[model samples]
Target: MDTRALSVFLSVAETLNFSRSSELLHMSVSAVSRTIQRLEEELGQSLLERDNRRVRLTGAGQEFRTYARHSLDEWQRLRRKLGSDEELAGEVSLYCSVTATYSVLAPILETFRATHPAVEINMHTGDQADGIARVLEGRDDIAVSGRPSQLPQRLRFLPLLESPLVFCAPSADCAVREMVQTVDVSRADFDWKLVPFIVPERGVTKDMLDTWFNNRGVRPRIYAQVAGHEAIVAMVSLGLGVGIAPRLVIEASGMADSISVIAAPRDLGPLTVGLCSLGQRLASPPVKSLWDVAEQTYPRAI
Candidate 1:
């Protein structure tokens, strides 16, 4: 079908007035009428019931309206997408938590940036659920997080690292010091039961903490609930509640003078961090290049 004539039919279908449709399309009214006639004849149907006084869609015109609108919208979207693909040569958005910067992920990202001088990498930090939502919605092409409990069908996860969940407390000769050294949360003097404790908002660390208690069937006494790994480390430094965090976080934290890492129990395993991305979306050359780099860097620590 002629695209120009199809456009005319669409405009006339919307306006239900040949003269108005012609004005909007910047075409002569006679040309608009001829286009509509061609469209109707092409489809072998009476598309418009019209005279000089009025115009209206016939059954065929009504049906064709849906297809016409859909086709024209798709064409416009395709044109816009080609323009966007050109712009994509410069930037790639990366989503991760603030704490990830302290781990291998940061080094990998630094290497990626160094190699791809033209590729502007934008980093967005947030909680894990928000990160998952961003990747699932196609907002961020890739996400670094604990593998979601239920991944969407359109996405795939690549396990990257397994970080042990450790118990940490102030090493100031407190009564709780023994409890941490033994890697025992069950002891009465752990102080975490009474003192301040920092926790993630709702990520792998929280799940690890919950599982630690649930597997033993003990209700943990909550002292405080704080957000962010840095904040937790700070709270612990201030002699607040104990903090349970990944080894990477506690190690990178400059406050070793204040808090000490407890030997994590053997029963409690490391949290699995991974990449979440849409399989089809990885088809872009740059996306695939970065994906390969991530897979190479991320798997070694797992």
Candidate 2:
């Protein structure tokens, strides 16, 4: 069977839409259908159940999808292994937030490119909160993420840098800012409940924030839960509510003048920012190379 057909099948299987898969594969819808038809004919089983309403994978198709992924992975591994030692070449898919793309990944990418010029870096930038989920879902090979409170057994983390998670409020005289200023930050009896809190929509940052609030017995008056720290900073700058974000994000944000860091209690720990990927994926040459370069670029903080 042609590997191109397998690739097309995988794309269609993932989207469950023939038109979308055709667009992704740069093939006409009829051509895409014919390729799948040929594949199914050779395999002697119906792989997909399609009708006007929807498209779905049959049990055979589901099993074939897994096989296709493994086959493609193995083929890429073999190609990389056979490449010239002086010029390593393959594709490496990476996911990271916009801030990280510029702030953290830029330097690492520069170094990696210098070392492995032939390796294609297929990078996707999105909300930092979704980095881990994207990696777990096999959308990407690696992701830049914060160390979650409970690290999963199937994943491996390589610590890069430490950035303290800090509370932020509008520099302007807003309700939360006024309330924050009224009470001494050094005092233990400060009424944290009065302050409205903005937080990440989901992910480790939210997990950390939840833990911090629960530990203090403070039922925070949440104002908003946004997808990214950049949005949180934007909201906080507008005096919508106080928010929590890593210090790295705050520094990278151009709105430093519009927002002020709250003197959060010492218990709010710093985020251990780093590279992470599935333990199984690290065996791939391109993935392992990037992982090693990142480790060398930013050795684990003592």
lDDT of each: 0.68, 0.83
Distance from true position, residue 238, model 2, in Å? 0.8
lDDT of 2 by residue, 1-302 (tens): 36788888877876789998798778999999999999899899999999999999998998897688677768777765788355666567798988898888887899999998988786778887788887776667899999998878888988889888888889998777898866764355667678888889898889988887677776777878899999999999999988888888988999999989877557777888888899888877778899999888886552
lDDT of 1 by residue, 1-302 (tens): 35676767766775678878778779999999888877877789999998878888888887886576456445544655777544223335578877775574676776676666665565667665466677765557688877655668998787888777777888776654544555566453444444445666676567767877776666655666766666777777666667777676677777767888765766777767777778865654456567777787765745
Q: List the residue pairs that clash in candidate 2.
A: none
Model 1 stretches with alpha carbons more than 4 Å out: 1-88, 173-183, 186-196, 299-301
**lDDT of residue 213 for candidate 1:** 70
TM-score, cand. 2: 0.84
Cα-based TM-score, every candidate: 0.62, 0.84
lDDT of 1: 0.68
